[model samples]
Target: MKDFFVSLLFFGLTGYFIYLIVQNMPQLFTETTTIKQYGLLVYRLIMVFVLFNLGIVSSKNYKRSKPA
Candidate 1:
């Protein structure tokens, strides 16, 4: 039960961070009207994906290493 709550908290925080980045994108720069803006978004999304995958793998390994 405790692990479940912790997992939920992690997911909630990740989602909130994503939401924040998307929410203020237009106001972030003055010249975002070009394709460069989309490029930046793609880069950020890929980085986020990689980080999330690392977190998942680390969590799984942690569980596997712990003896019940």
Candidate 2:
């Protein structure tokens, strides 16, 4: 019961964060110059990679702490 609510909150926040990122994605790609556009592209890619790894790590830790 408690665990169910906690997982629900975690997933809800993750979904909201993804929504915000998708909402701002166009602006991230809309730089005036080509170089700036590529820079933003690389920045976005790195951010995605970092976020993905962080999610994996956190989920692994959560599972470890869960009761068998």
Candidate 3:
């Protein structure tokens, strides 16, 4: 049960990060940028992906790992 809520929270975080990136998307195209800025964007995307996968794996494993 606890794992369920935690997984939901992680999913929510992933969604929120994606929302933030999308909301900022236009600004990236509207201005000049540097490699460092693009690198930061890639880093954020990787973090969002990790959070999403963590949510998926934790939910899937909880059933098998539940205490007897």
| Candidate No. with top TM-score | 3
Q: Which numbered prediction scores highest in lDDT against the true structure? A: 3
lDDT by residue (14-60, candidate 2, tens digit) is: 56656666776776645444776667656655666665556556666
Q: Which model, 2 or 3, shows the larger TM-score?
A: 3
Tens-digit lDDT track of model 1 for 9-65: 555656765876688687666754667666766766776676566557656766766
Weakest ten-residue segment in model 1 by summed lDDT: 1-10
Pairs with backbone N, CA or C atoms under 3 Å apart (clashes), candidate 2:
none
- Between which residue pairs do clashes occur in model 1? none
TM-score of each: 0.57, 0.54, 0.78
Ranking by lDDT: 3, 1, 2
Q: Give the candidate order by descending TM-score.
A: 3, 1, 2
TM-score of 1: 0.57
What is the TM-score of candidate 3?
0.78
Q: Which has the higher lDDT value, candidate number 2 or candidate number 3?
A: 3
